[model samples]
Target chain A: MSDTLLRLIRHGQEQGCRPHQRYLLDRAQWATLVAALADMPEVALLGLWGDPGQVHAALLIEDGLLIASCGVPDGRFAAFSPVRPGAVLFERMIRDLWGFVAEGGTDQRPWLDHGRWPVTGPLAANPAPNGMAPPQPVFLPVEGEGVHQIPVGPVHAGIIEPGHFRFHVQGETVVRLEARLGYLHKGQIGLMLGKPAPVAARFAARLSGDSTVAHGWAFAQGVEAALGITPSPRALALRALMAELERLHNHLNDWGFLCNDASFAWLHARAGALREAVLRAANTAFGHRLMMDRVVPGGVSDDLRPGGDAAIRAALAMVAAELPALEAVYDSHASLQDRMVGTGVITPALAMLFAAGGVVGRASGRGFDARRRPGYAPYAPAEAAVLTAGDVDARARIRLAEMHRSVALAKGLLESLPPGELLVPLPQRGGEGLGLVEGFRGECLHWVALDDEGLVRAVFPRDPSWLHWPLLEAAIEGNIVADFPLINKSVNASYSGVDL
Target chain B: MQGWRRLLWPRLAQGLVSAPLTDPPPVPPEEVVQALVARLEAAAQTRLGRSLAIRQVDAGSCNGCELEINAMQNVVHDLERFGLRFVASPRHADVLLVTGPLTRNMREALLRTAECMPEPKWVVAAGDCAVDGGSFKDSYAVEGGIDAALPVDLLIPGCPPTPTQLLEGMLALIEAQRAGG
Candidate 1:
């Protein structure tokens, strides 16, 4: 019944956790919260990560976000994965990173550690030497008559990031699909430690390259919130502008790729052209095609160049003019529709259980956009499309609807652009802050804790892909082997984003 | 009838282009191609004349370089027009466009991919990370760069090089191949 759920834990409120509070909980309190999470459907786990001698969980309860942390001085802690199935991967990662054992945790196989690292528990207080040879990963067993296995990737047959997918199939139908990721684990969070917020932001920006602007903005937002520094109005608007542009280009590319995987190359080519135009506009406006490191802690790094608005407008106009025809073609193509309409159906129950966000969630009848709830500045709450089909077609349709909204949002922000300084000096102080931004894929969450010397003590950047990768496995059930590529493209979960 | 009209409208709306949308090949492929052809003519003594086939590998990038690499296949860059194509398997590839800082998990896979390529192979490290680890340098999980795993013939620099820069890298690889001869 408490809006701040941490109040129910009877723990001391941490100081300087801006916009929201993080409570330090005792063992009993931590156990109670983890136990209660299973019964509470409204509370969603935004992130679960390990800090040296403590573990933290970010939860969304009754429209408010709060963090609950429990100290594990002896390297033992009660596991949430027993009650919350979504916490399983995080539990494994915590074990891999901090050498912490989660008592009664489910599926404790190593997540990020493949046994080839130079050191074990790289983020632990005292890292151990890793000398053992990497062993073959154990996948979940599937037993059925005529059930054979198909193994794919780590090095896929396309120009994309790497992650292995194991599929169990009976003839043509996929019985179970398991994804083994972590090929892109570069120890990003460990590298962020001891660096200032501005320097650490580079890691966040690279957390997921496709959502660079959104991730960069989320990182900047966390730093600003931690230091209690509000960026200038112009800086906020520019950040939003670049974020929407990013959303537009990525959406365009996805729409095309979904079709491309379905054997429709025409739409892919057209969509690719439109995406190129958007990238060119971003380069002209923000100095880089992907706009990496453009959003700094205090504000954006660069102002829009002269005539930047015009370039943005031109790109939007071309997209707007061309989209109707593209949509019509997609809609009218019976062959494409046949492949997409009923394929990769993720039921609303699974969507709700996983707290899936972004297009996938919206397509399956959940309309929780971070931009609208616990909202931030320089913009008003806008409409998010919700369709109930829960199929590949519904996902594609959601992308189309979101693309139109992004173009309009980018234009609106540019027209009302504020004029002022681009950045403010970040103060040297310690604090904790969380940032949740709606990226093209979904809500990207970044939680940061700074030391007294203003260096990063610990941070976790949770890409929406973290929550969706498991769902992809669920979505592939019953679909034929050949349709896996089409279904996978429809979901488009980022491999590198979650691997970190 | 409506479906047919919807599909045909775009083609009717815009006629064939007077010029290709992509910029001209960064360097004339002829001189380099001839050099390669001449060398191959001496070494293998087989009739060899065709476009360059590249196989792209993501060692551990943030996926920015992959996006630009994907864009190179788009209508604007149209990398195929420049006598370069991205094949699915390394066995069919003449060059390897490898990206990322070469994470420990990927180091073995990348080497295996390169080893799968036949003789007369070339490797181009296609981003700053692949060049020398970029921002991901000094991370315990990374080998620092692709060179740690395989011999790199060229390095394309940029956090993630733009498609134009990537195309230039391809051209430069061809020139390097010719110069090696």
Candidate 2:
């Protein structure tokens, strides 16, 4: 946390391109590095990169975008998870994918490679690092009489993504909840390695279908940063427009699902109708409902069709007009109020510890919006709405408030639309850069390291879900079993985003 | 309270008395019904019935297909109008609408879901990933497509086929069933 350590590790930006810094550390320095990062106020991410023969441990300090990395001689390194609970899952992932040993880590459970994989530690030198079959996952033991465990799905009755949840309950109250994800892991990072930035952008887009535009924008920004290509003003505005539309539609969808969970069918129906309208508008304007693969490294794939702005304006007006009526319905619905209010509370301390992003963080009194922090174009002057109730109602209200702001922002951006080229050609060069975008869910971060031929040597697109998913475990405690659906809908963390 | 009542009554009334919720069918209803009737008559020759029950298995999708599938049940598409419904259990299903490339972790679950269906059931691969693994074909964790694990009867191609496209695929499968091939 010291300025001296930050100066020692921080690499100066040269010629507008951020270079990846490497600090070759002896065993003593490695220990010092881990201790320094763990003492920081917030550790955004801690991960292991498996280069040809060496393993590098990288930690991203939340403030100033300081990334400190140390290369270890072998795969074994001192773990930071003992001091930082947020790094527990990351360390487990490091063990599962890279076969690296997080010495003295808290937990040893496998993260992504769940033994169903043909080979263990696919990113490591040896396919099967342990030279044996993966051990059966041991669920933490729950003591005390009359406590029972209920295991819910990798596949649920509803049409959703796959993830397993095990709840330890006493009578109707949930004592503890453990979530097991990664059923959707498709080796996305491995697939991105060695591919051109444009090609890898597709994998980033599909990381989570609903947040395609956000992830795609983040990936494009990272690639552009690495290549030192500044997108035209028109492209930046268009990207922001698309991001707000994405946020609007996704928030509407979540609101509908939340209403449905609360047994308010009428409001759910209305929300769904409005959401469909938004998607239709997007299709007319951007040529895809979810806008997949529309955002490339240099710029967007296409510009708004002629009069496309009019269609978006019409849709925005309709949504704005209808939202108040829907909000009235939601306010009048007594059953929904009873179910959502004062349920699934996350304390401010927990939110800060987990570095919760987006609505989850804002609702919990942690005002960390990437748009305002990194202050990128089109949103640099904009303010993100934040609230502090830390309950299901707060989460819902946060989304509602955001939807209103996004409508206003979108209209303003469209009215004052910039004129110029949508893309700038990128020179075939290689460097490393970081991109941070305020996605629908929260801040989506992508770090890219490119080779001399402009091929991606290493890429990590960290979804906000990494911070939010673990918080769900803490939020569900002490709540009754019946409130699980409402609580889960409130968080609505992305499984695919984290699984990848 | 008075203000909310003022706003809610008109919208509720409008919703209740609106015209048909969906846009008019792209194809003439009579012609489509005639074709469907013919297919149903031909399908009667086999053990399969005119109505189809579908159970969707998300092998490893990005949830894009699932969202589209959900859209089909909304007021716009109303897939149930075509005598096709998504059931909760595969035991009651006549068609398996599988999405995504089969991930290693989901392969057994997909197979088990398929096996639960009764005889004369067909599998419809609903996305590009289901057909040939799409962009994630070479992933170490994926088995490529549904064809690698289950017998696919029809392939509906798109990153995710639109709701109407999914409905069309279902109707085509009905025709394929009636053709007795």
Worst 10 residues of 2 chain A by lDDT: A11-20
Model 1 CA lDDT for position B116 = 95
TM-score of 1: 0.95
Considering only N, C-alpha and C atoms within 3 Å, which residue pairs clash in candidate 1?
A: none
DockQ metric for all predictions: 0.84, 0.64
Deviation from native of the Cα of residue A245 in model 2, angstroms: 0.8
Q: Give the TM-score of candidate 2.
A: 0.92
How do the residues B1-181 of candidate 1 rate in per-residue lDDT, one tens digit apiece?
9967976777666656456566676663455445544555455532223457999999999999999999999999898876889999999998888999999989888988999998777678988999999899889999887888887766778988989888877875555444544
DockQ of 1: 0.84
lDDT of 1 by residue, A267-386 (tens): 999999999999999999999988899999999999999778899999999999999989998998899999999999988877877778999999998788989988888769866999
True contacts kept of 2: 0.51
